[model samples]
Target: MSRLVACLVLLALPALAAEPAPRRPVHTYSIVARDPVTGELGVAVQSHWFSVGATVPWAEAGVGAVATQSFVDPSYGRLGLEMMRAGRSAQESLAGLLAADGAPGVRQVAMVDAQGRVAAHTGDRCIVAAGHVVGEGFSVQANMMERDTVWPAMAKAFREAKGDLAERMLAALEAAEAQGGDIRGRQSAALVVVSAKSTGRPWVDRRFDLRVDDHAQPLVELRRLLTLQRAYNAMNEGDLALERKDTDGALAAYGAAEKLVPDNAEMVFWHAISLVGVGRVDEAVPLLQRTYKADPRWRELVLRLPRAGLLPDDPKLLARLTGAKAVKK
Candidate 1:
């Protein structure tokens, strides 16, 4: 009986020693910065886990961007934006918030203002190899890096890269990866860029908002999407020119956009509008008819246009433009 008990005790001891401690909640860490020339704010992050976009990356059109990660308290994102809006400097805002948090040691964050003031924090009790670096108008922070060089590499990329705000942010992500990112591997990535001018229109105010929810190669796919976004912008410019009756300018812009994305329905629809603006009604009729047939709501809009003074007063011209029966309002 004593020998059997001794063997059982030996087996139990090894099992207990091998067991890992129960994991506490995870917090995210990231870099937030502003562009001096454009005043565009951005945030970039990498995590050992999946789909970090939900907990990280927050921004309002006119307010500063925020990245709340690493044993995270999500409230920091909202509170930081409020603090910045309330006239607190980035440094003061971060310091005040972290000082009040019970788990400061596990949180990491960085913020930059439109005036180029920057602030960053990396809690002492954070996982090993976590640190942050801040420079003129930029900040880079990382946790679970393979070495201390991750943040410095990111800082260098942000300063040296020549591109728009989104490109600069992407460079930082690439730099972190080159310096041994997440100490695990990549899963997801996201980028968002908002114009300094709100224009009171949310859809048009945001310049670039792209996400790679789950991918083996997120950054590469993100670059491709940005290219498509530029093409769409061209299409919008063409539509605006058409509205002003600048037929030549509208054609040039639409041609450039269509060359980039030829199959897009909006591009095709707007190009047809440009043709019509220049009195090419015969050419416009077929394209508009195709679009109307594909979407019945568009047909309804066409029927309502005569009453709104958008369509010609002549019944014959209206009938020729829309083959379907027109109901006089």
Candidate 2:
């Protein structure tokens, strides 16, 4: 009997030593919020693990935003968006969905509606210091934090920061880090915001969508990229105005964009085109020449402008715009 018992004990010891029971996941949280003025929905998230964007940050252009994380089951992201699209308010959708989840103790989530209704949840099985705070149009949540104050710091930052939706979300992430974010340290961060227009074109629908997959300073890099995106957005607006023959609007928008990133080749090139469109051809000549000199293919395209119906067919106008030798008849 003693020999048999020893053999069983040895087998059990190896099993226990080789693979322990799985502990609940600790790193996860999300924020779903509305932009009070624009009725835009935005979501942002960060995690100490890679590819947080795949599980966090969900938004429908006209409905709402949802961030689902912490022992994350991606079903929350897809279902939450579906619920919002089906006309459920943020609070109702969150409560009903979470109540039915089999692993509610391990999940974390935040959600906000187009009308600014907000809701959040932090599961009991999450790590200590895990909690969330809901503000007027936003909520901040964190789990597995290095300290107890991270969520509050995020709340304060979101409320106090001055900027658009994406900037405010970034502030929250920054504040959380300052208050001891992610007990294990950071790896990924993401921001997503959709406009009220619902243009049905996803590419142009984003007011801001940026991700830092793995970075030592992901938030800082995210902020820099946001600034660049804003500059390009301004440039696109300027071009749209130019197309409508709104010269004053075009000039103002282009100037604002150029001021943001003065050395960008695309900005310089478009500014020259806008100048020509408004009959400021002489002022445009130097810029056009510089752009064409930098890339001679631009000169070939300029020569074809008249045939493309983008410019007048008159030889004098073509020669003045191109600064090229006129074709002899």
Candidate 3:
């Protein structure tokens, strides 16, 4: 997308609300799920707490995802994944972490193993309304909620929701909020999903990590970011198709990306450039003209392309593309 699209979104962000004077207690609702078909593991969370996901959620490709909340022991995230990686089931991993921690009574946690088996705990010491709901391939947990129905609502939402793992996890978060989310209010949210198989390359294995550090409507912002992510994914696929000389596939990918963000000038500029690469200059002309009219800088960029060998070196093509007078050669 054009830098303008991103700038507009950024500019639309509201000023940060005042955070707690001290890093005091925070409570939240979150879900960890494994996609049955893709084996993709994901966790989504929202809280009345600032940067809630920074400390609350963790995942490792081919291992499991973890959310350690309530008294919030960050170790559970690290240790649970480690234990599971060492061959422990989700139950065993959680048990081992709770056993090692002296303050288990005050902590709440959940884990979904690589195989989809889930285990969770809600300590009696966690704030009132704290509890968890375990369902097939997923678990929803909440504490200090507006009502005890928060976790249960999340459970039902996950069960009934349709789409990819991220969307379902998001639905659960939305359900939690609808049922009465954090008694205090809303702040930050995050989503993390990883591939089921260990690719050895961490970056390649991990997918869809998004966060809204602090926002009045964190979930709403999270959804917008997710939508933007899908467009970029389509753009990436289009790039790869072009690399393989699959013109039809490339165009289809660009078309899908454009459809996602119809007004994204940057996306359209690249789409037009791609058409030019495929010798579809006539079809690309209108797109380029619209792009250039909005910002002549795009025309300057196109003029530079021939020097970079990214576009045809022909003087006629360059003049037509840039709307510049033909250079007498």
Candidate 4:
């Protein structure tokens, strides 16, 4: 092996031998689940630790999801997904990791495979009020919590919640907080949802990946980010429709995005630009006026688009949109 490869292998030996590895008391609540309807796999977590999102959750598009916390060995999240990708079931993967751990009693972990198989572990040595629940296609776990009811509340909320995988997992996190979350109070949170199947494109496979590194109300901040992400997702769809010359689809998508964030100048400006592109000058005028009213910079942006081919070079159309005469070159 190369020198670097040798060093990496040697470093990983401790984990293989079940030796005690350095870990943090990540004591937190989390969920791992597969959406039956969308085949999407996801993991969501919230903790009092700074940037808990970076350590606790792991997932693969066509394999499974893992959440490792409570004196967390991040190896569980990494190796667990590896095993699942290699064809092991979620339960088998969790069992193998637990068996190899020198200090399993201090760990809290959960997994949900792509096939909807579920497994979870709560170490007996975990802080008080620690526990987990394994439901159909999902698992919820928590440690160092203010109340033992947290995990149960999460399970209940997830089962009854409406919307996609991201929405449901978010509900679980919110429910945990409602039942008195981390005894130390919340600091950071993360949510990740991957497509049911791989498109051979990692970027395309991740439908939602959001994090609130440190916040007084991490879950609330996380939700706002989710909404913003949705609006951007709509904008992307509109762009794609424009490329395909599908005017109706483009309009619908831009309209959806505008409705989601009506106050967003960027989305409004783009929607107006799109309307003008489809020869709907009258329809574009009001949207352009609205955006120009919100920010004069948008009007300046219009004067530059013609040169970039984003808008036609027609002086009459430009004057109508900007309510100003175009200077002759």
Candidate 5:
């Protein structure tokens, strides 16, 4: 009977052994930074994963920015921000996250607090070429990259780049790509920047929140989106100037926006309309003519403006806008 029991136990040994756990590799790279001069915080990321930014990036006005990737537990983003907001330093917040997490070896996360303090953690079990580079006011982290040089390249580029926080952060991303980004290739990207002071309004405090949910060349698309965002921001400022009755300010802002994106037909059309709305019909006439010359659809929209109440009901103004000059009183 003893021999039979021993044989039975030997048979069950294979079944009792634990299986290897699964790996959830985010396989992404990112930067979390704070502008020393402005105190603004920013986070940017690119990954083969769908809507990578929606999970990997998090930031709060006057608190800190966090990027959590590689078997991403979005809870790290929320909890990290909560701890930072509650006065924890970047390192402390990271430690808290690691302590609470059951599987710390598969995670890669970075954080930068409002004071420019930076901290990062790259799990031991993260994919090859996975690590982080802590910088003066930022941290660059990557996992499952094509080479181990990606994070270092990002650090060098970010430190050398001459510009504002956003520009520098973007430079870091460009550098990462130049060094060979993800092992799987690029899919989605995102960027978010917040002001140093909390305005008590989420929208007001958020300076930029741009994302490319799905794209073939996500980094290039991301850069283009950033440029477009700047031009649109100028347009918004111009609109606000118009609201305050600062006509010169409005025109200057609008012209700045147009200059940023000279070929944007919609921008030119709106500027012309705003010009007419301000009783500067003479100034608007030439711009409207130029836009209609380039895009006949602008003229169609102009013709519909009267019925839509977007433009005055004056036929003279309508005629000039449409280049017909049919003045009917």
Candidate 6:
């Protein structure tokens, strides 16, 4: 029953279970946060309900992040972001929504706006082992959990953890699980992060949006997806470097992407191509060989690159790269 002072009043209200129960009782643990250094806003959640990712997490760049669960009402996420987008703070937006709701006592929701103001609510009618903790730039909340320690452990982890918004939020989720997470056990999870400022393009502003729709171990799969996202992020940086004609910078970025997923053929092939384009054929050979051995289609793709003006038209170089001809002294 531990909770922030603001939520005490809500807890004192009569239980709303007299009304019909929400069809989707998405009881879960979640956190909404704004990164102090990057100004990025994000929300992460794990639940026993199926596909919690689809309903629990919502965020808008330069506005706020929201997590709505327990007896979930998805309108909280949409309307909360709408309010924050219209200049309302997270606290103001959540308070207004709760005030107008017919059954606020059954909902669990948290929000963190771009400016880092955070607020949360855990309705009195929520199941046992339920509570919330609001910190400087974040709010950690949980309902129907294995223990009351879940949200506090989440808050502590997010406070002391290092890294960007996505990583820190993930740390909070991991901590919740370490405290015996959802009472019914894990099913689905989601993590979403948006830029500090909007780019006017919705797709571009969504930095890291990932979900594990259904998994026996949702948190573990979510972390793996995050790693893959980072690798692809490095690849994009490499592409940007190439556009800038910074060959050395491109190589460094590509090398990083390759190291992140050494077994990924796409990353290995691109790193090899970048190295060869820089006239570091010797360094490129091993990487090319690795990809070619894994799938002969990569060698075929290399052969087509010359005709597309992406590679030199020299037959000798192509032969040597494909391992058909020996490297010259």
lDDT of 3 by residue, 1-329 (tens): 33433332233222111221122465889999999999999899999888987888999999999998887877678767877787778887776666555677888899999999999999988998899999999999999998999999999999999999999999999999898799988999999999999899987787788999999999999999887777888888888887787877777888788788877777787788788888899988888888887888998788777776567778898888877789433
Query: Can you rank all candidates by lDDT, best first?
Result: 4, 6, 5, 3, 2, 1
lDDT values, one for every candidate: 0.70, 0.77, 0.83, 0.88, 0.85, 0.87
Query: Which candidate gets the maximum TM-score versus the true structure?
Result: 4
| Colliding residue pairs in candidate 2 | 28-70
Highest-scoring model, lDDT: 4
Q: Residues 1-329, candidate 1, lDDT per residue (tens digit)? A: 23433343344344434552223334333567787888877776656556777667776666677776667655666667766666666776677667556577888777765466788888898777888888887778887777788888888988899898888888888888887777767777777777665678878767877777787877777677777787788877886775786777887787677677666656666666566657788887887777766775665666565565445566666666667566453
Q: Lowest summed-lDDT stretch of 10 residues in model 3? A: 14-23
Clashing pairs in 1: 27-69, 27-70, 27-71, 27-72, 28-69, 28-70
Residue pairs in clash, model 4: none
List runs of model 3 lying over 4 Å from the truth: 1-24, 307-309, 327-329
In candidate 6, what are the lDDT values of residues 57-131, reduced to their tens digit? 999999999999988988788778877887778887788778757888999999999999999999999998999
Q: Which candidate would rank higher by TM-score, 1 or 4?
A: 4
lDDT of 4 by residue, 106-185 (tens): 99989999999999999999998999999999999999999999999999999999999999999999999999999999
Count of clashes in candidate 6? 0
Candidate 2 lDDT score relative to the true structure: 0.77
In order of appearance, the predictions have TM-scores of 0.72, 0.82, 0.88, 0.92, 0.86, 0.91
Kindly report which residue stretches of model 5 are placed more than 4 angstroms away from their true locations once superposed: 1-24, 274-283, 293-297, 300-315, 327-329
lDDT of 2 at 10: 43
Q: Is candidate 1 or 4 superior in lDDT?
A: 4
How much lDDT does candidate 3 score?
Answer: 0.83
Report the C-alpha displacement of residue 253, candidate 6, in angstroms: 1.3
